[model samples]
Target chain A: MGVSVALVITMLELVGLFTFATSGALLAIQKGFDAVGILVLAILTALGGGILRDLIIGDTPPAAFTDVMYLVVPVVAAAVTFFAHPLLQRWTFTVLIFDAAGLGLFCVTGTLKALRFDLGPLQAVLLGVMTAVGGGVLRDITARETPALVQADSSLYAIPAALGSAGVVGAYHAGLPLGIVGTAAAVFVFGLRVVAMVRHWRAPRAWTRRRPEVGR
Target chain B: MGVSVALVITMLELVGLFTFATSGALLAIQKGFDAVGILVLAILTALGGGILRDLIIGDTPPAAFTDVMYLVVPVVAAAVTFFAHPLLQRWTFTVLIFDAAGLGLFCVTGTLKALRFDLGPLQAVLLGVMTAVGGGVLRDITARETPALVQADSSLYAIPAALGSAGVVGAYHAGLPLGIVGTAAAVFVFGLRVVAMVRHWRAPRAWTRRRPEVGR
Candidate 1:
């Protein structure tokens, strides 16, 4: 039962990968990238976080190498966008919805992977956050734009991912039903993030005029 | 003696960081970046790899937050480049030399850190290679170009860094003086890389045609 649940989650995560890849390719197009650049950005946006996660866990070759679907999905998404960009640009809100789904799936998947590696809860949560944001971070860096997660005064994107991961792990330790508990956690995170975005909720900034003292 | 040797290496690494930061700032200027972009590129080029290394190792806040010099050097380098870029552009070769030195330092430092954390030889070497090339990889992605490391035909950048790091670790285990052996290893790597660049030497590519058997 747990294996089946994990499989379903993995499948959803792949869907998320494709969505993110399309978004990346669209951004590349907006930036006047040629075909090659669009393809590269798509691949990076899809696989970059997973690659980082696997490398940190000492997994050789990485899942991006082993899974044929992972590679095919991104390439196909980029090619589709290349051909249908004129039509797709009309559905901008739809793309953001897909991007949000990808974010949620990746956050949970990353947390689960970290836990499987026997990392502590804090480390697991951090890994989850990194996995959720890493691809977008790579995308922004590639586009030479300030990473929205870091620079924008927006609701806590990483914080919610961390919270969701912690919740799932907590429920798992408490011997809850895997599918029900995991789904609940994911929905909670996704819904909270949507609310935050809609309401324009943001993390408080402790703005100060005084320079903080530095320790040697 | 060990402390003094580490300090000296750290100082040299700072110099290299400064040079790379200046180069990054100049690139930003050529790309028509404003002040924030210049600072972003400068810091990213200088400290990006070390930050990634620390994050992968599950170190919080990273070394950039711990060391004042690490933060200061890049900013100072950016300011210098902002004011002196016209003159510096004439000395491109000199800047490249400094960049090479920084690359050597980062590779060795990364390898040593991995070994200290009790990772095996292969893992240590991989970490060393990533640490050396990771920043530049980010830089290229930011610039929307193919990473020099992964391009089909490029100079032997990562290979030498890996070999040099492995050599240093191997020599250390064989009971060589740490300072002398390490410095020699760095110089060997730097010289080999320079030769490769000058001679346009590169790793041989394997030809693959599109075929069903090729598993595309």
Candidate 2:
């Protein structure tokens, strides 16, 4: 990877990590968790997806554990949220944009990584989506709520990640430059997610409450 | 490893996997999940810890995915629970014993595996406890509940797993025979867990509610 590409990926991943960590901290506050709980949620939200990806891909100890900055980023985000709740709360829109960027970047990166490990393109795309959304799934679980990925109330979320990942895979197969592929995929996902948020575009939910089947 | 020891470990692990899967299925039933959710929970709860362990230790794709029996056990367990909810519901104590057995075996085996991978005794013991409790954690999270391991209302669960892992580590470092050491540790965890359950030996909960602090 070129130095600039490497730099872009790292920066986007960091942005995603911080946003998810903030989300986690906010949930912790809502759940009335003490300081320890906030930290726990933030750290998990930041690292959970990557950890799961690393584990599945045979990456031991996970980069988050080996690299100090990854751990420090979540801690800093959580601390900031804990200390400045109101100020940060008002910047929800800004945070969402960063989060969408992070999601887009992670999906592309995770898919490419999985592909490098010889996973099928389909599997790679799934891993990409998982990388994008896994952290939030963990965050919700920790806070005792249905994961937003699977919730009825949420707008299209995982769909954008999947679409972004598929785009990267498609671009790679078509021999596009890696830089262009990654950037285009991330922008598409980020743009779609932001638009979905604003316009309230939603994924269809399952038919509501099928009548309980009669007598077993 | 001796054939006898290997056989014993396999049997115990199967029992553990089945029980944990049952626990997952039961929880899914409680949550009113459909067939797909029940199976997902069952399989995840059955295989999650081992998957996490293998990943941490750099084992890719996880053994559960490759081994058909491992996949089959949870599927069967979920199907049984789905078909015979009332009958299985009455067998809760039986399921608990099996779950405890699985926990004990997993902790012992997980620690031994970590040791073989050259993880320090401390890290190995932690992996051991993780292997014991990881599945249930995934199950609870998927169902949007605090894991019983981390819950304040639960009896000593993770404690027995930890103690079992510790004992194996202690025994190994003390230069005991592996067979005797592993069996003893498993038995100890199993006995402790069952006794704790029977006695309702609760872990102390943090004080009910310190009145949520107001005014940020």
Candidate 3:
């Protein structure tokens, strides 16, 4: 709750918002969607998970709906992505880094938020993962694609988020300071995600056709 | 709030739950999803909208999550659909009827719930439409299909839901008895949806390539 810690979380959130909105707008542009489509996807990507979480925690109107800045930031990000996409296309790696950072930041924050709302540690962890990945799942669904959260062959996503969520929830249960535990959890998630991406790590596939070991 | 009125809404809600769950299970079966997949979609399609509405209305834990019967009904429906989809496939018209019934029922119920939470007429009506159509959107998203809720070529899905929501909100605004207005609003939606289906009514497309007069 110190000023520096609060400042860092805020910065992470803003960066995450921008990256998620950019990704949403980029997807819309690729799909040849109109301006409205771009705006809708951008807003949903940036704030959908938080809205879902707030709603579950009995927060009416949602923070996004109330905070003009939160709403406007995503729109601004989307507009920039839409207009400067050609130049931004070359910055895919940077986008991925920022996206991973955002994922980590959100998972820890979400779990902490749930804990603050007096949810059980288990529910807190799960909701944390939901908050981290829900927006991307929604964005993919809107784009008519199999969401990465559920896809078996996709790179590490929900798993890393879940780990980060568990970390924060566990730390909270151990009576650790929120600022320190949150930072450590976020770092853990961000590091794992970035490494996984760099190594092209694929998660386990559940329904592989090559299950010859269980042959009839 | 009369016993009879409450009973009627309860009946409609149960019927809607069954139909939505069945539709969700059927979709999962069609998509070759496992039992878990069927159950997930069934539950989501039956309860996702109400959960969304409750979250929006600051109703924590959601009724579906808390009520044992609400959780069980969808599971039962999914199981039935899983085992009897072949037989149920022949009952397409029956499914349509139930789906339309659910659409009407949820809109009114959601709006009423929102009103109970002291929401304004606009939010109530919007939440009503969201409750009506949200399950199907989640269902389609899970199926990796473009949801009909926002598709241009799809029939009057959101339109009818919105109209039903508007009817209830308007009647309430006009100070009509809840029991009478609620029933009447549901009936109006059901009748319109059925007629639209039978007549093959298609809503107009927004982005047709043949905006011929706009250019050479």
- Give each prediction's DockQ, rounded to 2 decimals: 0.05, 0.14, 0.12
Summarize candidate 1's per-residue lDDT along B1-216 as a digit string, tens digits: 368557655765687578668766766787788999899988888888877776665565777789899899999999988887787545545545656766787787777766665556655666676677777676656656556554334577777887988986786578666667667777877898888877887754322122112100
Candidate 2 on B74-121: residue-level lDDT in tens?
899999988987875456576577678778888998888777777776
Candidate 3: CAPRI quality band: incorrect
Top-scoring candidate (TM-score): 3
Q: Candidate 2 has which clashing residue pairs, if any?
A: B16-B102
True contacts kept of 2: 0.22
Q: Where in model 3 is the C-alpha error above 4 Å?
A: A1-11, A25-44, A55-97, A119-126, A141-146, A150-153, A191-216, B2-29, B32-44, B55-130, B141-216
Rank order (by DockQ, best first): 2, 3, 1
After TM-score superposition, what is the CA distance of residue A81 in candidate 2 from its true location, in Å?
7.9
Q: How far is candidate 1 from the true structure (C-alpha RMSD, Å)?
A: 10.9
Pairs that collide, model 3: none
Q: Is candidate 2 or candidate 3 better by lDDT?
A: 2
Q: Lowest-lDDT window of 10 residues in candidate 2 chain A?
A: A207-216
**Residue-level error in angstroms, candidate 1, position B123:** 1.8
Alpha-carbon runs more than 4 Å astray in model 2: A2-48, A51-102, A115-126, A138-146, A150-153, A159-216, B1-48, B51-101, B118-127, B137-146, B150-152, B159-216
| Tens-digit per-residue lDDT, A1-216, candidate 2 | 457656666776787788778877766665556565576678777888888887778768776656567777998998888777665534446556656766777787788777667788898999999988888787776767667687656778899999999888887688777677887898889899999989989997556587544322
Local accuracy of candidate 3 as per-residue lDDT tens digits, A27-65: 788788999999998988888888877777776787788
- Candidate 3 DockQ score? 0.12
Error of 2 at A76 (Å): 9.0
